[model samples]
Target chain A: MPQTLDRRRLLATAALGGVVGATGLGSLAPEAAFAAEPAAVEPGAPDPNFVEGRISKISGHLLLVTGSDTVLHSIRITDGTSIWKLHPTTFDQVAIGDGLYARGVRLPDGTLAADSVWVNIVNLHAHIAAVGRNLLHLDHKGQRIVAHVVPGRSAAVYNGTPAISDLSLLRVGRHVQVLGAWHPDTNEIDIATVYAAA
Target chain B: MAAIRGEVSWFCCGTAWGPCGTAGGGACGTCRSGNYQHAWPNTSDACYAITHPDTCGLSMSRRTCGFRHYTTNLCNGSRVGTTIADCGPQTDLFCGERTCCGSACGSNRIIDLTPAAFSAIGSLSVGLRPCSVDTV
Candidate 1:
């Protein structure tokens, strides 16, 4: 355990060093580090291979989606397509009105041959207003969110420590970040992991 | 360009459970949930169009696959370096969304990191964090 902690410390130090080196703040001008925009593609063109939106209709293996930007898409799910809600799941678990982020190849017919589909996955930074057995009441941008902790699956990381299944270290009134699957049409979510400062 | 401040979040890819099962790597086909990697909003023109960070009054340069970036959590000052393995966190979807720690606040979704990368600097349960992203 001592060795593990030492290693983590070393890694943390090295990461900090890398940040300093990248910024060149100590010896170099900030503009020197900031110059030159990175490479990019032309603007306003549609990404032929990715889509993010709400599922308006589900027909067989096809999902009719209306993007947050209001663009329409037809997403085709095949046997190879991976689906995740709270965790990895299947096509049958998907429902209408669920938000989705899909990545795949664009077919000749303009359908997204989805290789992966994540439904209602949300990451929110919130304050842990209260805690109960297997539950956390969160305040996200002033909105209340009920976060359910699933033992054996949900985990917690305090400060920058490695993740662990024990969430006992979590405290009320602390700011935390939660990554989990959002229950479609609800303010609740199944906690996958919670990040908090110890 | 210099590092830009905004929010950072995590997503699953490569090997995992639930909907992530079929995610097979990521857009770059090299992303894994356990790897120190990230999804950049402007990986390509089409990617930029979809994320449209500009809609939130932020401009991000287009970077392709394998680009390396460094992200720092403002709250704890922890940092992580990751490679671009996908396109991400459609910015415009949550336009005007803001997150903060103490007096430090940030708005807009600029980056989506894999579980591995995010956990390096922040916890996954605390989904959104005020962060700064830069090329390294």
Candidate 2:
């Protein structure tokens, strides 16, 4: 009984602080975050546990998605599911036509029981052409991308260090990887994290 | 060859759309966003002149287009094998930058996979991942 109680406490903390923990998952196993087993995938193959597409329909907790290749998917959100739309958000923030990437388990019925879903999320690699007071101009594959630094939301990771909100370390002409939510049909993205070399 | 420790990211090519710019078949004229492909820092003396992984203290070999490499996402132990389809990931820019997944860690930007290859082992939302590259 005591063990179960402790597990619940740990889960509660994980629920609120998962993304804040970044890629390491903060000591929590991917299995610990959800009850279902992830679909088995061969090494170097497309992960069946992951899905990416645009939400074409939303009915209650179910999301109908159409992939960029026109593949269809049904994702079910649970109480344990974490949603992000520009920021950590709730289910209501999800809407039609929003692009999404989900990580979860595939149920027997082919429905994805999502443990986490990032709507409008885009990971971009580019050069920091210039840094403005609260914005960044990025050169991505010869195209310019405008990145907005959100106060209290945007963070930076330098030289493998833990994430910090101070973007001072970012420099022009440096290569960087930016993780943010795309502004949908625009060259703009609201910065979530910028990983750079110091 | 021993598995090289480094950072792995992704890009688009072969008429890819949205944020890919005019990537257009990459440097090899065969890369596609849907194919299992990757970009290596050292494809030739000319390509190496640009990426210069050695500046980051890495002695990567000149593996040209069509070469196969297996990449593992250290964050999750997921692995994927891809053919070299481009020359890229200017390593000199982010020299000394590193990332890790628990005890497993890596330094430098060594490889760039396609959307099909990268999203298979890791989430696109994460942008970059600590990785191990080897021939399997």
Candidate 3:
């Protein structure tokens, strides 16, 4: 409770550097930030640096997660933890029953000091059934997915190249892996990054 | 066989969300989205006809369902063990595609993992990573 008050006070007084920006937000993306940190666990084993499951409970900055095999985990979200739902958001935006995958350092007390959390994030591989202006009609497996390209924010990486915003290279009948945030209970998604054939 | 150098991505199988709802238990019939399973491009003749990895000059021996293969994300040291549960990745569509991390690089789509299997090695959002597929 006291910590909450202190955080609120800081938020009210501090000049926020994070803005609803006009450029690529990859630098602020949690996954990229955490991706460099090598996993301390054994290969093919559960990575201590990552967590995945449904939200069982949220208490202040702590989140209780029921992972696979009903393994329960506690996640401590600090100010440093970048939470990306569809886009970068705050701690309050998280709600119960929402699925999440988190990457961070595991504290000695069995709590994960989260560096980042992706809520309802999905990665999909599909073919470009069609393409409209800033819109992509995806055929994932055999199902259709309507992926919206968020202007300025949405970018594409062609065959491991540096990301670029110009999607004119996106042609029909091409395969692509889309990185985006899923719309709750819907088939639509807001694209953040697209990895595609050049 | 030696580890095949290639790129890897993930797919949904079994009962899943959104467009993945239509995804059944894959070609193996034992596939599940939550299991450490994968889709191979060379599962059968018909499957090969669809994926056509050979069009890229990559020849793979026939591997049946339930065959175990290990995939290592070349970007990181993380690896995962999965069984063949489906046929996919339509390799010919993007024959010369490649992805790399630092000095290590891989080309062509050789493997497709289930969501459960993929999240084990790398974040789902960073799709299409360089990888090595092996049997051990």
Candidate 4:
């Protein structure tokens, strides 16, 4: 936790310098900056171990994740752990408006890594493969995926698709994407984009 | 100009015996392999021959980034990446023997924008020439 916090602070300081645009202060040229633009490097392949999912439920510290293959993830967020040097909070302190990027491990109890957590402030893209009563099961590739919609955020459904008796709509074959954080434990992602992919 | 190159075959800290010659192999922690090993882009190094005629060096690692690329060493039979540091000798933290600094491995290649500029139609696209090479 302390290490994450320190990295975040350092990244924040670097960002501040970047925004200021001072020449001698490591001003990143536009071309160079574009080249270094951060992109998600999917750790490993489509293994459930290194999957990045959305938070569907947060019961205490456990995050039930429901995307990129249905799997319950055990997440642990501590003070100062940051991604890309950004400090985003987890735990009960986290809410619906978040995203999660995690590195998985096979714990002795058949759970996953309690380490390497990233709560994204921005939503991501995923293809919805299934939908259920107040719950949408998604798929990225052949993986079975799912998401839980918050009440006020329910409008996120494509054209406000109701979440009841829509099991038919949640077909075995469909494409839908989502954007949100994966709870540290449980590994459920908050729904951000429940739309079609082009 | 002598076009030289060097490469770090593999680097990982694990109990595995023998070189996997690739990162992330043999349960090693977050092993990095490939050409994109340097943290900074557009960096370059000179390659040279090792002072000693014998000895294969250790697999080099980079703190700034992940992965290593290789080329054939001019003096030794070892194949290394085409970087200035790879051609030379001795030992140190970043590079030893014919190995080169991983930071300058991939970036040494000349920047090519012919495909990008030629995307447009008409003679205007053909006239697009790079003003100069800049390092990052």
What DockQ, on C-alphas, does every prediction get? 0.06, 0.29, 0.19, 0.02
Tens digits of per-residue lDDT, candidate 2, A60-160, equal: 77899887657799987766666777777889988787777776666667777776787887667788999998999999878898999999999998877
Clashing residue pairs found in predicted model 2: A44-B79, A44-B80
Where model 1 places Cα greater than 4 Å from the true spot, the runs are A1-46, B1-136
lDDT of 2 at B64: 85
C-alpha lDDT values of all predictions: 0.68, 0.75, 0.74, 0.30
Query: What tens-digit string does per-residue lDDT give for candidate 3 at A1-198?
Result: 552223222222221233322122233343343334333333223355567677889988789987644778888776556777877788999987677777666666778766567787777778899999788999986778889999888999886678899877988998888888777556588888887875
Candidate with the greatest lDDT versus the true structure: 2
Q: State residue B63's C-alpha deviation in candidate 2, in Å.
A: 3.2
lDDT of 2 by residue, B1-136 (tens): 8999999988766552345436788788888665678999988889999999988899998888888898888877777788888898888878988787788788889999876677667655567788999987
**In angstroms, how far off is B51's CA in candidate 4?**
51
lDDT of 2 at A138: 95
Q: For every model shown, what is its TM-score relative to the native structure? A: 0.52, 0.75, 0.72, 0.27
Candidate chain B TM-scores, in order: 0.96, 0.96, 0.97, 0.20
Model 2 segments more than 4 A misplaced: A1-49, A104-111, B12-25, B28-37, B44-46, B64-66, B75-78, B101-103, B114-124
Q: How well is each residue in B1-136 modelled by candidate 4, as lDDT tens digits?
A: 2332432121211111111111122221332221112111212222112212122242322212222322222222222121111111222211221212222222112111111111111111111111112221
Worst 10 residues of 2 chain A by lDDT: A30-39
Highest-scoring model, DockQ = 2
Which model, 1 or 4, shows the larger DockQ? 1
